[model samples]
Structure formats: structure tokens, C-alpha cells
Target: MHDTDDAHSEQESSAIHEPRLWRDKGWTARVIKNEDGDGWAVEMIRDGSAEPALVGPWTMGRNKVDPKPLDATAHQTLVKTASEVIRRHEQQLHAQLNKQCSIETESGSLTVRLVVTPDEFEPFGTLTAVDPFGDVIATVKVPPDFKLTRTRAERWAADGFGRIQ
Candidate 1:
């Protein structure tokens, strides 16, 4: 009755969609012809990104004309390597966005930090100073591309923690 109709609908829906070429561990692997050289390359793209997270050389078959077909083991390896690439990229970005510098101030050793918050409309940054005891002394909004250096940190602290325009 109604159950049979529902089952038929589900089967039709499944049949209408084409199977994915390659999917593993939240990533998709695609092999493309190398433009620069006479070989092939593989690209690993994360689930939601149009750009590939990682692209590298792929093995050639014995005929030396075509790329070897992707298999389960190759997909797993590509996924692992792509995940690592994404992880490293994130870590590098985090380090660049958040910087810390130490300077000797009259009061004591002060820690200067520059934290950047990226936004689509307007990116913002903050320059902060903390005492040796981890107490925030001052925080000022700065340009998102502010660079934290020892000399700049000392200057900011010596200027009474005012805006460094």
C-alpha cells in the first residue's frame, strides 16, 4: 500500500543520482592532467571547498601515458596527506594572526600581544599589554595588519599604552 509506494520512490531517487568519483575521510580526490609537464597529478579537496587543499604528482602506468586508476588505498593516503596540509595551513594562519612579544618596561617585563580578527566587511585587530602577573594593562584597537616587534612593543609601552597611530 503506502509503504510500497514510499519504497518505490526511494529507489527511484537513488537511481537518479550519479555515484561520487572519490570520497574518503571528509575529502575528495581527483586526478587531473599536469599542465606544466607530461604527466598527471592528483588533487585533494575538502568536502565544502571548490579549490583543492593539496595537489601533487601522481604515478604513471607502465605505458607511461595515463595515470594509474585511483584505488581505496590511494584515496586513504591522499586524504591523510590533504588533512595534514589543511592542519598545517590553519596553524600557520593562527600564528600569523596572533603574535606575542616581550619587552622590558619601567614597571616590569611586559608582554605585548597583537590579535587579529578577520571579517568579511571590516577586519579588526587589537594590541594588548599584560604585566608579568598576567594582568591586562591596556588594550587598543589597531589595524588588522599590525606587526608586533620588540621595538614597537617597547615604544607602545613607553608611550603610556596610548593609541599607536
Candidate 2:
């Protein structure tokens, strides 16, 4: 006979398709009360995540007071939307932490890249200059808020790649 704990674990791991809840394909769709209004809302949460990736208004049922029952099609749509939200958020964060520019120097053209490390205690940025042949000419540690523009890269190159004030 299976133990009670094992049975509970098995139930949790299996797919659930209830009217207000649907869990499958590593995502869960749940209908919840809208705190901001009188209507109902649906939230999509990825498995193992603590918070929902997407939440929006849910359609009303025929009676007009209750929310529409969750279906396979609705769950799939929610998963797609929630996945897109996470992807876009990651892209935005990457853009914020990494920057690149090209500048012409006396020696040759160099590509300057600034990548910021988001440390909790000591956030910092690394400024790197690479030649056209992909050789790193110079690298320096800078403050996380350092802006990397073309003009700034040219000035850094002109300053002998020393510490920036």
C-alpha cells in the first residue's frame, strides 16, 4: 500500500483540470477574485515560481456573476502570454546591464563594452575595449552607474584607459 505522503505527492505531481484551476505543461492557471473591482481575474504562474507571471481580467460566465470555467485552450493561451512576459522582462534586464559602443582611436577602431554586475552589496561595472580582431586591449572596473556612450568611449581611449572620474 502507498503511504499517505506518497499519495499526496503523486496527486500534486499529476495534471489537474478543474473549473477554476488548471495545471499542466509546467504552468498553472487559476481564477481569483479581482481586488480592484467586482469582476474576476485569472493568473498564470509557472511551476516552482512564487508569483504569477501574468494576471488579467477573466470573462464572465452565462450567469454574468461567476467567472468562466477554465479550459485547455484558455490555459494554453495563458501559458503563452505568461511566457512572453517573462521573456520580455529578461530582455529588458539584459539591455539595462550591458552596453556597447565603437570609437575611432589613434591606433585603430575599438569596440567598448560596459557590463554591470548586479551585486547586492557592491554593484560594479566592467569597461572593456576590444580591437577589430577581438583582442582585448584594455579593461577597467568602473561604477555601476557609468554611462557608455560613443563620446565617452573616445574620451576614455584618449585618456590612456586610466581611471575615470
Candidate 3:
């Protein structure tokens, strides 16, 4: 037998389309009063996220006092823009937390990578050395702010992958 509770929950969470609010396709867009000025603003929040993914100015309607009502095309555009904003934020975060460099040492050529773990109390980074065959030779924990430049990597390799001071 089908679960009535599940069906009721689905109905409760279903799409909602109103003049100033829209909820569909895993996103919710709501028109709000602009905190900075007299005009209005809109905020798009992804499903299950506590904060809005994108917020920006909203246009006024023909009356000039009421904010423009959201439509299908506007919702789609807002979804695209919010998704792009989230994508760019993720890319920038990954770039900031990960770094890589290649260096030729006396032993051989190796690729070094620094992966940072952002812990609340004690953040740290892991330095890993990979051989040409894609095998990890060594890994050492270092400060989260460790700089993994080519010269630094070469020096680390020269030191036989010892713990950096």
C-alpha cells in the first residue's frame, strides 16, 4: 500500500507560483524590499540551503510602486544566474584549498600536491608526492598556509620527503 504521509509531504512541498514568490525546480525566488534603497530586490535560494544563493535588484512594475511579478522566463534566468554564482564560488574555494607543482629532483621527477583541511580549531594541509607512474610516494602534514611553489617542492623532494620545519 502507498504511504499517505509521504504523499501528503510531497503535496505540501510541491511547486508554488505567486505574484511575488516562485518555488519550482529545486529553487525558490522571492521578491523583497531592498534593504539599501527604496526599490525592491529578489533573492533566489536553492532547495535545502539555509541562505540564498543569489540576491540582486528587482524591477518595478508599471505602477512604479509595486515590484515586478516573477514569470517563467524570469525564474529560469534567475536559476541560471544563481547556479553560475554557486559554481564560481565552488571553483574559487577549490582553487584556494588545493595547490600543485612539479619539480625535477636528484631522485626523479615528481608531482607535489597540497590539500588543505579547513578545520574549525586546527586547520592543516597535507603535502603529497606522486611518482611518474601516478603512485603516491609520501605524504606529510604541514601548516595550512604552506606555500607549495616549484622551488619549495624541489627542496622537499631533495630532503627525502622529510617533515618541513
Candidate 4:
């Protein structure tokens, strides 16, 4: 009987430190009152990131005046959705930052790569070409806003890989 009580007390103590507004598991889900109107919103934040990865409206209670109270099932569902949001955001960012395409040069087929560096204040990218033997043929700095597309890359290769104008 004493052991059972001790285990229960231990679980209760651990729960005390849990955040009321947030839950963390390499990411966090936080509930907040919606700013625009009557609903609620949940914000998903990844660890070490300053911004929320996702934010969406929450459900309303039967009364229609207040948000449905968050419970274990709702919290679990929110966490799963939030996790996917972060995963998709990461994939999109990766795709934007690193792009590669192949072009047929007079010499041979060359690989073109566009890698972007995004920063808070300034953004920039590099366009690079590699020969069949893995030798870097040309490298150019491009504006961060540069978009890498199949047509644009092909045009660059056909134009002798010069600075994009």
C-alpha cells in the first residue's frame, strides 16, 4: 500500500513541472487565444528555433463561445499535426536552398548546382558548374532571389555560363 502511494506521488510531482502553455519533444505545441476573433490557435515551435513552425485555428466548444478545452487526445493529435508541419517546412526549405540540374554543354554534359544561403539580414546564392570529371568549371554569385528552373539553367548553359543579367 505504501509503495503504491509513493508511485502515485512521484507521477504527480513530475506533472507539476510540465508547462501549462506548451509541451516539448524536440518541438513544442502552445495554445493561445486567437487574436483576430473568438477562436483559439495552436502554435508549433521547434527546439532552438525562434519562430513557430505552424499555427492554426482550434476547435470551438459546443457552446460556441469558447474553445474546446485541450485534453490528452486533442493534445496528441495537435502534436502529430504540428510534427508534420515542421517536417514539411524543413523539406521545402531544403528544396529551396539546394537545387541541381544537368545541362548539355558543347564539351559534354555538365551538372549545374544552385545553393542558397538565407540569412536574417541578407540572402545570397551560388551557381556552380562541374565537368564530367568532377572538375569545377565555373562558379558565380547570384542574388538570393534567384530561382532555379530547368529553362533558366538550360539558358545559362547555352549562353556560356555567364553572369545572369
* CA displacement after TM-score superposition, residue 4 of candidate 2 (Å): 25
Off by over 4 Å in 3: 1-13
Q: Per-residue lDDT tens digits of candidate 3, residues 1-165? A: 379888767756798889899998889999999999899999999989999999999999999999999998999999999999999999999999999998887778899999999999999999999999999999999999998899999888888899997
* Clash pairs detected, candidate 4: none
- Compute the lDDT for candidate 3: 0.94
Give the least accurate 10-residue stretch of model 2, judged by summed lDDT.
4-13
Q: Look at candidate 1 and give me any clashing residue pairs.
A: none
lDDT of each: 0.84, 0.94, 0.94, 0.77
| Model 2 segments more than 4 A misplaced | 1-12
Ranking by lDDT: 2, 3, 1, 4
Candidate 3: minimum summed lDDT over ten consecutive residues — where? Answer: 4-13
Sorted on TM-score, best first, the list reads 3, 2, 1, 4
RMSD versus native structure for model 1: 5.9
Candidate 4 residue-wise lDDT at 40: 84
**Could you tell me every candidate's TM-score relative to the true structure?**
0.80, 0.89, 0.90, 0.64
| Steric clash count of candidate 4 | 0
- Per-residue error for 9 in candidate 2, Å, reads 12
Better of 1 and 3 by TM-score: 3
Model 1 residue 162 CA deviation (Å) reads 1.3
lDDT per residue (tens digit) for residues 93-153 in model 4: 9997999988886788889899999989988899999988999998888998888887888
